[model samples]
Target: MKTAGRQTDAIVLGAGIVGVSIALHLQERGRRVLLVDRGEPGAETSHGNAGLIERASVVPYAFPRGLSTLAAFASNRSIAVRYRPATLLRMAPWLARYWWNSAPGRLDRLGQAILPLIERCLDEHRQWTKAAGTESLMRDEGWIELYRSRRGLQQAVKAAAELAAYRLAYDVLDEAALQAREPGLLAGIVAGAVHWRDPATVSDPGAVTRAYAALFTARGGELRHADAAGLQQDSTGWRLSAGGEDWRAPEAVVALGPWSNDLCEPLGYRFPLGFKRGYHMHYAAAADTAPRHPLCDVEAGFVLTPMARGIRLTTGIELAARDAPSDSWQLDQAERQPLAVPEGFSLRWLHRDGAAPGSASLLTDALATLDWPAGEGSLYLWAACEHAAFRQIRAAARQYLRPEIDA
Candidate 1:
C-alpha cells in the first residue's frame, strides 16, 4: 500500500465515475496512480442517477423536435427530458446547437460513438464487479421503454430503426405483450413497448463504487482524502493542491463530472459542463405485486428499476445549478407519475421525508442505501453524448504526453 506521503506517476482529480475509471484503467497498464477526493467515493452526481447503462440513450435528450417534445412532457412530468422555464432560457444556445446536431445522420454517429463506449464500460463494470466479488449487484434483465400512445410510440420508431441497424437486439411489444411480460401496466395506459435485452442495471451504485475502490487499492493504486482545489504546471509535470497538501505527478486527468468546470477553469480548460439534477425514491412494492424487470417510461424522463425488496423510481432532469438542492416539484412529478400496476397490487413510498409527494422507491433494504456524500465521495462511471468530445481531448492529451513519458 502506498502512503499518502509517496509521490506517484499520475494524479486523478475528482473521484466521480470518470476519474475513478481512468485511475483503474491506468492501474491496469501498470501505472502508479493516486485518486483524490474531498470526501469518499461515489458521493456526488454519481450517488443519485438513473442507474441504467443506456445502450439505447443514443439520441441526445435535446435533439430536433426536442423543444416541442419537452413542451409535451411539461404537463405530464413523467417523461425523459422535462424543461424548466428558467433553465431553458439560460440553455437556449446550447439547446439550439444540440437540436441542430440531431440530424438523422448526426444522431447515428452520436449513437455509434456512445453505444460502443457504454458497451465497453458495461463490460468493464462486469469484470470489475466479478473481481471484487460483487457481480450480483448488476442485473441483465433488459429494459423496457413503454409508450402510452400510438403517436408517441411512432415518435420512437427512429430510435427503433437505429437500434436495429446497429444490430442491438430488441422487441417491439403492444399493450398485450407488455402486460403479459410485466403484468403491471394500467389497462390502456401502454400502447406499445420496446425492450432492449442487452442493457444492464446496477442494484446499488454506492456499493459497486466501494467494491471498485477496494479493487483499485488491491491493484497497488493509492486513494487520498482531500478536496481537489486546483492544479498548476510544474517544470516536468503537474502540481496538484488539495486539502492544503501539494503533490507532483508526471500526468493528471480530470474526470470531475459536473465539477469539471470549477477545477479546470483556472487552467484555461473552459468547458461548459452543467448539472441536470435527477431524483429517485425507493418504493416498497407489495411482495406479490412487484414488477419483475426495469421499465422506462418512454415519455417519462426516468426509469423504474425493481429490486428484490422494493422498486427505485428514478426520473426527472432539472437543470439546476450545481450544489443546489433538487427541485422538490420535479421529484414530486417523478413520484406521482403513475405506474401501470397489476390488479390488486399496492405500493407505497419508502422514504417519504426524502421525497416531495408521490415518489417511488429505488430498491429494497436488502439491496443498498443512498447515503449522501459527506465532504467528498467516489465515482459512478456513466456515458453520455459527450463521450466523443471527451475522448478527443484524451487522445490529444495522450499525444502531447507521449514524448514526456516515453523520453
Candidate 2:
C-alpha cells in the first residue's frame, strides 16, 4: 500500500450504522469518502438495537419526571435502568440539565423540533434498504408497546392521542385485542398494548448496516479498518493511516456513536456525553413462538424482537462507563423475566456474555458542522439540545486545546 495519499473529499470515523449511512450519503453526493473503523461495519452498537426504525416515536426520550419514578431509580434496583454509584457524582450536573430540559414545555418543544427527523426515519432507511437490496430483511408492520397495567396502557393511549397532530398510526389494544394480534405473546402478564403501525423492523440490523456499507463500497467509496486514535489534522486536512498508508481528507465527520467521544475528546470536542450501556441476548424460539412484531415491555423496560437467530431481547440503560466490564446482574434479571426462553449454542441455548456498545447520549443533539482546520463548533443549536450542558461543555472546552469554539 502507498505510505501516503492525496486528500479525499471526506473521511467518516466509525463504520457503525450512523457512520456507514453518512458515508453512503456523502458518496451519493459524488464526494470521494473514506469510511474507517477498527472493526467491521455494524459489528458494534448497530448490531444490538431492537431492530426497529421507530416512526411512531414522535417524541424524544426524556428524563423521568415523576417523583415516584425518580425515587425508584435513585435506589438503583430498577430493572429498566441501573446506574453506577460512582457515576452519579460526576454526572450530577448533566443529570440536572437533563431533568431541567425534560420540563413539560421544554420537552414538547424538543419533540416538535425533532418531529421532521423522526417522521422521515423510515423513508431514509427505505432508500438505503432499497439500494442495498436488503428488502427481504425488513418488515413494514412496525411493533407493539406493552403495558402490564391499565394505568400504564391508559397513559400510553393518552400520549398517543397527544401525538395525533403528528399523524402517527397506532391502536390502543385491550387484552383481547392484543392477544388476538399476538397469539403467541404469552400476554397473561400484560393488560394491554399500543400497536404502532408505522415503524418498520428488520430481522438483523447488523446485517442491514453491513449491507449499506457494502453498497457504499460497491458505489466506489473506500473503506478502511484502522485505529482512529492516529487521526490528526494539519493545514491540508484530517489524516489517518491504515495498512501503513497515510490517508487524508479535506473534511471528516465523527459519527462513532457511543465511541464518538473517545476520538472527539482528543480532538478537543469533549462534552459531558452520557455513556448509557445496555445488554442483549437471543432466546430459543421460532417465529410461531414469538410475536408478529417486536414487543416492548414498558414496565420491564426491554424490547423483544423476533430475529433470525431467535427472539432477541434488549435491556434498558445501565449508566456506566463505555469500557466497564460486563455485569451479570442485569443479565440474570433479564433471564428471569417473562420473555426468558430455555436454549443452547447450536440451536437451543442462550448466550450470557452479550453486551451492547453504550450510546453517547449527548445534551447537544449535535454539534453544528465544524469548519476544517479552524474546527470551531456551535452551541447555538436550540430546541433539540438547548440546555445548561451546552454552556457547561462550552466553558469546559475553552479550557482545553483551544479548538476555536464558537459561543
Candidate 3:
C-alpha cells in the first residue's frame, strides 16, 4: 500500500456506530474523512448490542434508590448493571468515578446533554437506513421495561417522572394489557410496564452496519480497508499513518469505542470509555414464542430480543477490554432466565464475540482522571431520577472553558 498524497480533512478511528456516524456527519459537513478500524465494521460491541436507539434512556445513568441495591443485592437485579466480579475487584479504584456519576444529579446532567443528540441521531439512522433500503430489517417497535413486583412498579413511577421531564413518551401497562400485547407471557408475571415508543431496534444489527457503510460509499466517501496505527500532529494539521500509507487530516475525531483510550493515550489525552463487556446468548428457537417488542427484565438483568434470525437473550456487563476472554460463568448465568422463555430456548454455548473475562480490559485509570467516582453507587444510581449532578458539572465546564470555534 502506498500513501495517498492528498491531505485528509479528518481521520476517524474506529468503525463502530458512533465512529461511523461521526465520519458521515463530518463528510456531510464537507470535510474529507478517513475511518480506520482493526476489525470489519460493526464487529465489536456495537454489532452485538440489543440494537436499541433508546430515546427515553435520557434518564440519568444512576438509579435513585441505589443504596438499597447494595443491601438487597439479590432483590436488585437491575442495579447490577456492570458485572465481571473478578475483573471489577481488580479495577475497583478505577471504577469509582462511575459509581459517583450514578448519583442522581450526575446522571440527570448526562441525560440532558445526550438527549438533544439521541432523537436526532435516531432519525438520521432511520433515514440513512431507508435510503440504503434496509427498512424491513429495521423495526420501529418499542422497548418494554417490565415489572413483576410491586417494588418494580414503584421504580417505573420514578422512571415515568424522569421520562416526562425529558419529554419522552411512555405508557404504563397492567397485566391484562401486557398479556394482550404479548400473549405468550407467563401468567401472573406482570405487575406493570413502561413502554418507550421512541426506541427503534433492528432485527440484524450487522446488516444495519453494513448498510451504513454502503450508504457512505454510495455518497462518494472513500472506504479504506486498513489498520490505523498512530497519529502525528504537524503545522498543516494531523498526519495519520496506516496500511503503509500516510494521510493528513485538518480535523480528526476518535470514536474507536473500547479502543479509543489506547489509541489516544500516546497523544496525551485519554477518553473516558470503559469497556463494559456485555454478554448475549442466541438460541435456536424451539417454539414460535417470539416477542414483538424487546423485553427488559428488571430483575433478571438481561433482555430477550426475538429477531428474525433467532432469539437472543443478552445481559450482564463485565468491565474488561475488547480482547478479554468471556467469563464462562457470566455466559452460563444468562441461561438462567428470570422468566420462562418459550420451550426449547437455550443459551448459545459460546459468546458470539471472542470476549471473556480478562481477555481485554478498559483503561479504568481514565475514569479517575475524568473525576468519576469509584464504587457501586457510581455504577448504579439510587437517587431520584433527576441527574442534577451531571448538569452542574457541565455548567461548571461551560463557566470556565471557552466555546469551541467552528472548524
Candidate 4:
C-alpha cells in the first residue's frame, strides 16, 4: 500500500483496452509497468462499444459528402447523429476541421495510412484472445450492414466497389438473401445488406478488455486502484500520490479517454478533444430469435448486436459536453426494430472524439514547457476511438507513437 510501484519504469493511468494493451506492449518491450485506474478496468468507455472489430473498414467513415445528409444532421433528428444546439455551437470549429479533413482527397490519404492497422486488427486481436482464452467471446463471421432504402444500398454498393483495392470480402445480400442470413429482421423494412466477412465481433467487449488486463498482470505487470488525479510531474519524472502512498515512475501514460483533458489541463497540456457521448441499451435475447450476426442499421447509424447481456442497441455520436446528462431521444429513435421490446439496463455512455489539429500547437507548447525526455506525447494520447472523426485522431495519434513503438 506504500507507494505502489514506486520503482516502476512507467505508470499507465487508465485501464481501458488501449491502456491495458499499452501496458502489455510496454511489458513486451521489457518495461515494468504499473496500470492504475479509479474503477474496474474496461468498466468505463471500453465497455460500451458495438463490439465489432471492423477489420473490413478499409475506408474510414468520413463526414457526409452529400447535402441531404448534411441537411439531415442539421435538423438534429437523425438517429445516426443528434446534437444539443449549444454544445454543437461550442464544437463547431472542431467539427469544421473534421468536415474539412473528411474531404475525399484527405480521407483517402488517411485511409491509406491506417489500412495496415485495420487490416491486421483482427489477427492481432485473435492473438490476444487466444492468449487470454477469450476466443469464445469473438465471432469470426462478419457483421451485416442493413440498408433501409434501395438508394442507400446502392450507395453502399458503390462505396464497397470503391474499396475493391482493399480486397475486403463482402457479400451484397438482396432481400431474400438478407432474410436467409437474418430471419429475425422484419421483412420489407430492410432493402438489402452488405455482409462484410472480414471483420469479427466480440460478445463482451468489457470482458475482453478485462481479459487483456489479466494477461498483462499474468506477465508480472502490476495493477492498482488509484485516482490519476494524484499524478504529478517533477524533475525526477512522474509521481502519483494516492491515499497514504506516493508512487513514482520515470514516465506515465495518460490514456484516460474523455477524462484526459481534466488531468492534462491541470498539467498545462489541454487540447480541444470533443468528448462525444453515446448510449446503449440491452434487451433480453433468445437463441433462435436474435440475428445471427451483428446488424448495423446503417441509415440509422446504430447497431443491434447480440452480446452476453442480450441484444445491445448502441447509438451513434452525440456531440455533448463530457459531463452532460443523458438524452434518451436518440436511443428511443433507434428502437424502431420489430424485435421484442427491449427492457432494462439503459444507460448513457461517453467516449472521447473530435481532435483539433489546431491543438497540436498547444500540445507542443505544453511539452516545450515541461520538456520531458522523449516519447511521452505519442503513447500518452488516445486509442479510445471509433467514428471517422476518431480515425483522424488515431491517424494523428499514430504519428506520436510510431517512433517510440517502432524503436
Model 3, 163-217: lDDT tens digits are: 5556777778888888877776776766877787777777777677777767777
Q: How high a TM-score does candidate 3 get?
A: 0.80
How would you encode candidate 4's per-residue C-alpha lDDT over 47-124 as one tens digit per residue? Answer: 777788887877655667789888988899887788889988887887776677788787777666566667667766
Which residue pairs clash within candidate 2? 343-348, 343-349, 344-348, 344-349
Q: Flag regions of model 4 displaced more than 4 Å.
A: 1-5, 242-244, 337-379, 386-407
Candidate 3: RMSD to truth: 7.7
Write model 2 residue lDDT over 268-342, tens digit each, in one string: 766545667777787776555666789888887777788877777777888887687877566567666765222
Q: Per-residue error at 385 for model 1, in Å?
A: 7.2
Q: Give the alpha carbon lDDT tens digit for every residue of 1-407 in model 1.
A: 63344467888876655556667777877778888888787775555544566555544443436567556756645445555677768866655655555666765565454444444555656667788887888888778888878998886766688555567778888888887888656777778988887777767765666677778888888888876655666555666655456676766666566565566566554433444555667777665567777887766556777753357776655554445544566556555566666543324666533643211111101011111111222212122222222222222222222311100
Specify the poorest-scoring 10-residue window by lDDT in model 3. 377-386
lDDT of each: 0.58, 0.68, 0.57, 0.69
Comparing candidate 3 with candidate 4, which one achieves the higher TM-score? 4
Count clashing residue pairs in model 4. Answer: 0
lDDT of 1: 0.58
- lDDT minimum window of 10 residues, candidate 2: 379-388
